[model samples]
Target: MNRKDQSLAALVAVIWGFNFVVIDWGMGDVPPLLFLAARFLAVIVPAVFLLDPPPVPWRTVAAVGVFMSLGQFGFLYVAMDAGMPPGLAGLVLQAQVGLTILLATVVLRERPTGPQMVGVALGAAGLVVVGFGRGGHVPLIALVLCLMGALMWAIGNVISRASGATGGLALTVWSALVVPIPLILLSMILDGPGALADGVAAFGWKAAVSTLYTAGLASLVGYGIFNGLLSRNTSASVVPWIMLVPPVAIGSAWLLLNEVPSTGELVGGAILVFGVLVASRTNRIRREPARQAANSVGEPNLSDPTPCTPDLPLPGTPAQPAPAVP
Candidate 1:
């Protein structure tokens, strides 16, 4: 990637890392379900007008919307409200990548390389270090919620890959449009007008800013850029950069929320990075050979679509094993 792209990617990373801070802040003012409902509502207005259609089928687009937009945020918002720390929320969310990898293997039937297998081992070990190393108690309900969010996200990744919805900003917008109806209904059924009124009455500039940042900038712009990277780059090249979010999240938590990572979290972070690198290394190596040969022949190879698809292997799916390359 060029310096400019790298800079943009870093900016997105920062936005995403800070998203937890915003989420935490918003949760204080709004109920989790209502917060998600409002956030997604904000998404619909701008997305309807500003975004273009993704290049995928409508079914694929709707699936992406359900998983990535609705389910992921729904579960995550609930998880955070249920006491999942924002800093760790970011780290645990990285588990989505691993889940995606596993799901892709099953649904897409793609096989992982040796490096990826090593990554799985390393990442699993790191989780063990993080989960059980310290005298920390993992919240079962919160962890389950996060896993649900990851599954939703993984399904979205597969749908994106299957449909080749590499339209980036346009696709993000379209996907954002998917869940307004359900969210509105959910808000009515669960939160009720009274609760929502309370939230709105209590909503200050801080809450408003957090909502806008999360829905508009973070989800919209961040995903836009992320999809751009996925569309233009290989999974090996792009997926691992996601691993950067955890440390950034930890730092953001410390700086913003004064939530410091425990010693075990630190150790787990290191392990997570190591594992992601290993899993990504094989794809990187394979791409290198092909890119070199393509360069020699004066032709660019652009076969793989965005890695942000719902086809990524996730938990709760059978291990069907995909090929090395998508």
Candidate 2:
């Protein structure tokens, strides 16, 4: 990768990693759902006009927005507020990697490689280990909520891939817009206007800064840089670097929130990382043959080709304009 790309990636990793701590702080003041709504509101107000419309069909965009923005964030915030540690939240979210791979096999009908299958198993085992390690101490409802949140995130990932705009910032921004209204409505339904008013009244500069960091820096700049990387490198090559997030998140939580993982938690995290590495490496192997074929034909693609339109033929596969998303 070029130095510029590397720098941008590093910046994104830092922003995303730091987001855990910010969420922890922000949740102290605002209701989780309201906090999430406020976050998207911040993003939509300034950047929505600048972003182009989503490339996929409106239905696909809306579906993806629901999974990615509302479902994922809403559940995650509630889980954290329920006493899941910030650093642990980061680790748990990594489960989305495994879930996404599984969903791709199911929804996209892509076959999983051996390593990926093993990786998924290993990740499951790791979660089991973490669950048992916590014994009866951890809240079952909280754990279930976190896992559900991760599943929603995985669904969102597949939707992004389906939309044929997997690596685009415009899609991310558009999804942000698609999510905020529903999120606000949901917050009102669940928390009521009085909860919203109380939360807003409690909102201080720190909370505002936290929301800005989440919306502007983490959502916008972080995803922008991430999509930029995907547009430049293979997912396998770029994704391994994401492994860095858990540790960064853990360290940040340790320093800022004094939230330290137990030995069992650490072991669980290591296993999770190992599982993700295996899955990602396996997926990379699966995509390489297609990439090489594309490159040989002078239609080189930096990322994995979309699988939804197999008949249309990918750039390197043969001369065929890939069908527009239906």
Candidate 3:
């Protein structure tokens, strides 16, 4: 990633990191799936009509919404309800980093270099340190659910990367249309109609403000930028930037919520940053865009209005466009 994009990714991570504090603070007695439904509902209104859908097939948009937004958060909210600590929830969620890299290797066949592998390993170590440092008795089901969330999120990452669609706003909003109803139905079923009704009855200004921030900034703007980054960078190169999130979350909690970071967390935060730097290599290897048209991460400047075409051919591979949106 270039300096400009790296900076943008950092900013988005900070917004997302702080988002946890806001969500926990404002959630009150609202059901998690209902809260998520509200956020996505907010994401769609105005924006959906204002901007056109991404220039991809309807199925592509739906796939992203299913795995990335609905599947990821559905498992997470359920896991948290099953008694996962919010701090540990944040930590466990990032398991997607390793998952994304591994999936990219298997599916996309985008191999990471040795240094990149080491960087990813260091980042994973940082997460482990952070997880251990923030000790909690994790329930087995919640742990499994969280891992499922991570896997869904990783699949979403690869889907977005494969789509090669760089217009983050369009993809984020249009795909979001696939979210609210199913989640609302699930919220009603799992959380019960009474719980959902009660949660809505109790919704207040705190929840509203939280919803605005989460829906407006975190969901729409944040993911818009994130989707673009995925299309513009390799999954390995882009995903590790998320390691910064836990540290930022901890630091923000310290500053605003009076939750001081432990010594281990501090060390782990440093390691995460170093790991991202190592993995996202400062010197980007740029590839000249084919037909001077918009394509993969190598030529970050171009835009593909027609959704995706192909990844740059791997060395010695046939000059055929790679598979996409499967």
Candidate that would win on TM-score: 3
- Candidate lDDT scores, in order, read 0.71, 0.69, 0.83
Measured against the true structure, the TM-scores of the candidates, in listed sequence, are 0.78, 0.75, 0.86
Candidate achieving the largest lDDT: 3
- lDDT, residue 201, candidate 2: 92
Q: lDDT per residue, candidate 3, 1-326, as tens digits?
A: 88888898888888878877787777778898898889899999989999977887889899999999999988887787777765667778899999998888777767776667788899999998987777657899999998999999999989888888869889999999989999989888888999999999978999999999999998888899999998878887788888888888888778887877788888988998999899877434333343234344344335656555545678988875533322
lDDT of 3 at 223: 93
Candidate 2 per-residue C-alpha lDDT over 17-78 given as tens digits, one digit per residue, 9 for 90 to 100: 78989988876767788888889898777677877775678787677678877888888888
RMSD list, candidates in order: 10.1, 7.5, 8.0
What clash pairs does model 3 have? 232-297
CA lDDT, candidate 3, residue 151: 95
Which 10-residue span in candidate 1 carries the lowest summed lDDT?
Answer: 282-291
* Model 1 regions more than 4 Å off: 1-13, 133-135, 232-237, 280-326
